[model samples]
Target: MEMALCNIKNPNELWSLESCDELEQYGITISVCTDIFSTTILWMEADNNDGDPSVFLNHFLDTVTRIGGCPQRLMVTPSRENEHIATTQTFLRRNHTDCYAGEDSVMGGVSLRSHMWIHTCTPWKICFADLRELGHFTGKDLDKNLIQFCFLHIIQDHLEEFVGRFNKNISDHNILRSQDDGPAEDKLQAVLPEDIEVCRRRCTPRGRYPCDETLFEYWELIRTENGWEVPVDRFTALKLYLHLRNVMETCIDEEEQVTCIDEEEQETCIDEEEQETCIDEEEQETCIDEEEQETCIDEEEQETCIDEEEQETCIDEEEQETCIDEEEQETCIDEEEQETCIDEEEQETCIDEEEQETCIDEEEQETCIDEEEQETCSDEEEQVTGLLQ
Candidate 1:
């Protein structure tokens, strides 16, 4: 006969004696392990098939309960087994207890599971069970989610207080408060005396209580010394810090925008001034050019006048020369006339002398005649005498 081995795959699947009998007839043996929390199954060969399976299952349940069914303890190796088992035992003890007796009993104290159960049972109980175990939590322990939750709670309870402390009137007209509101107050009001008395009567002073006074006083004390505390006063201080930070950031952005606008305006003004200066320079150049042209025209006119004066002087000199030549010709004509007159006078004088000579000749001839007559008489007388002789 060939021996066969088969394993059941799923614990959730139906198991029956009839199926086991059928597997046995085929010479097969099966074993199963089930995890209660996950509803999973593990299958393996039935090495010891002689024992009853019911007895084994019952023993496993009992053992799992005793160990609190902590998966970490079951999975750890021999080196870390002691630590894992200790942690699981502490959780089991805390789960069973309702509250711790004192600080000495805080080690292996009440777990968060018990506190959650209590919270579910009494929804109004705001117990800080974990704080009792850990003494205090701060900084990294206080994340944004917790801070926001605390902040909302503060706003719900003390909104009026916050507004009044800052001297802000949140009227219908004021939608969002302006930045002009003064600084926020550093401290917040403690819980009322009647509320504290009620809390005191309801629970022990050192024990966990649900009222606002206990939490507020506790946080204030912690903050006074450490400067870091949990959101006990509804996170009033944290809200103020956040508000101031936002205001400072807004102011900085506005200043930067104004500076940029001023710079652009200055640049535009400078450009306009430069354009005006260039236009003025062009106008000056045009005026200088016009003046130079007018000077050239004046010089040209003066030159033309001088040329005309010189031409007139040349004409006057020519006229004067013509007059002098005419005067010399007139003088030469006068001298010729004088010389002809002198010649005529000399001719007339010569004629008179010739006439005088002719008259004298006539007179002398007459005298000679007379003298001849006398001589003839005398000669006749002499002739007569000579004739007498």
Candidate 2:
């Protein structure tokens, strides 16, 4: 039920699957069915030790596919060189039909970028915030740069196009390494393309680099000189935690919550529901054999009792729902009233401002008329006094 991760040092370390049957039957157990898909993923570093892993990868894919396993994500370590990365990218695009190019999907690739400040870092390039914070590369794992690159890239490649090319030089390299006194399986190294294509067409113009700084810091510590010394604390289920938190916030306020659906899981659920209906029919037939074909009084009485209980429960639920609905309506009315009150207050304020301006203008006009009348009367009096003299 859980996605198992082997927490060990070194990308060259041989990773194997344990449960084949149960995993393959996942579609049967899950109710949904249309979302299953296969992503032909290649994992391992080009520079991690001197071992060939092509045979192992081919075997892994074949085994998994045979048992009904479909890969949604193709997680891999960083490509050996820029050209190798480009060749791989191009190959995946031309050959791998489902190369993810969206910025918001979970089923695409996870690539490792070489540097932070470089522009040649593919438009879909996964860059690091600070090299010191990369916690997953430790001791021998430090040299396992490609593996670290893959993890970071996965987080970063939310929707970036990768450039890939074929390399002709490292073609004859052995796929497996030789341990002391024993020969072990080697890593898979591919022949990358010589020419690369920049994949800008599949990207968004405003897409930004990986943004979670805290996660980067924790991962950087995964590669310690003392060998990935991360604490083994109980980790919370990210979904349950996030969902509960979002619900509480939503209850008190209003905001959109983020969600995702695994296509495989959805398909499995649909399959399960169909299977359940078939099982229910078989169980009903078995019951008929034991109870006879007649509509017995006991069966009718039991059905009536169950129906009554359901009806009562429904009534109670309806009552509670009605109360809640009324409360929501009241809240809506209160909001509308508040908005209306504010509009009225704004209109009254404007009217008062206009009245103040009009009053000031009228007072100025009356004072001007009085001054003119006084000047005219004074001038007439002066002319009469001069004629009498």
Candidate 3:
């Protein structure tokens, strides 16, 4: 996944192509320490290596193939790093390398999408195909997580190229609610200022990037068209707001249930009737959340129990040491009484050892749990509380 995102230079001149072909057999470690240098990383490493583009492309292809992902489908999203790669990538490729990158539609692609998305950051109509073929993927849990992460990626990509693919294939994206105008940019742009304002206002906090109640509210407001052939350009504002409100309520409810500290508790301040519109979805979400909270609580309890047990062990060790000290004191007294002439040096030596051992035990106890650690922990808790407040 890391390799997929990092841009590389020339896609040729990989050292292993001929060797892998020329020799049918290869060693175990040879395959393990595969040296397909990141084109991005190598570009920074001007200290060594040849300027071969062929080797670079081969390395790129090798990485993509290893990941079981298609090279053609791989495209760099709009980013400053990519802009750097755009002008300088070809130059860095050695003679043996060849960069098999796609056409440079990055800049324009990003700008248009950003403009169109300014109003509706997420568009659900694009997921029409995914909605149509939703039943094919049996693992609903995996699908749910994947869809969420994919939507996160889709929005984060900023480039419009993936929009087509997302509209066609990304299932479970029925959750995104985007508003697209008509064929004529002018026609689409003609949406009533009031209506567009309604949609844009529906997504507050500017970017609507926060994953709090605001996000839930935005997602919940997205509603399906009433008819078989859904309208593409318009949105059911009321329905969308209702969805957003539901999301906000659900987030609040789940957030409250798993609350470990009062500071982490999320407030469910949204009004009742407004949140009731999507009760079923919100309720189901609560059930899932409760189960997750139960698991988290159990894990936390286990850790707490382990810490308590460790403290108990420390306490027991201290008690045993104290008992040993009492026994030694008795022994020293018996020797002193029995041999009225017991050496003063011997008695002092024994007393000094006992005092040293007692001091050492006290130091160990201090190290285990003391005023310093408690003060630090208390200070951290106070700081966290202040932040939350």
| TM-score, every prediction | 0.23, 0.20, 0.16
Q: In model 1, which range of ten residues has the least summed lDDT?
A: 11-20
Candidate 3 achieves a global lDDT of 0.37
Decreasing TM-score order of the candidates: 1, 2, 3
Clash numbers, per candidate: 0, 51, 41
- Candidate 1 regions exceeding 4 Å error are 1-296, 354-389
RMSD of candidate 2 to the truth, in angstroms, is 42.4
Q: What are the C-alpha RMSDs, in order, of all predicted structures?
A: 35.1, 42.4, 46.1
TM-score between candidate 2 and the true structure: 0.20
Would you give me the overall lDDT of model 1?
0.39
Candidate order, lDDT descending: 1, 3, 2
Off by over 4 Å in 2: 1-302, 370-389
> What does candidate 1's lDDT look like per residue over 67-172, in tens digits?
3332211211122112323333234333333232112111221121223223322311122223223432222322222222234343323423432432333232
Better of 1 and 2 by TM-score: 1
Would you list the C-alpha lDDT of every candidate in the order shown?
A: 0.39, 0.35, 0.37
Better of 1 and 3 by TM-score: 1
lDDT of 2: 0.35
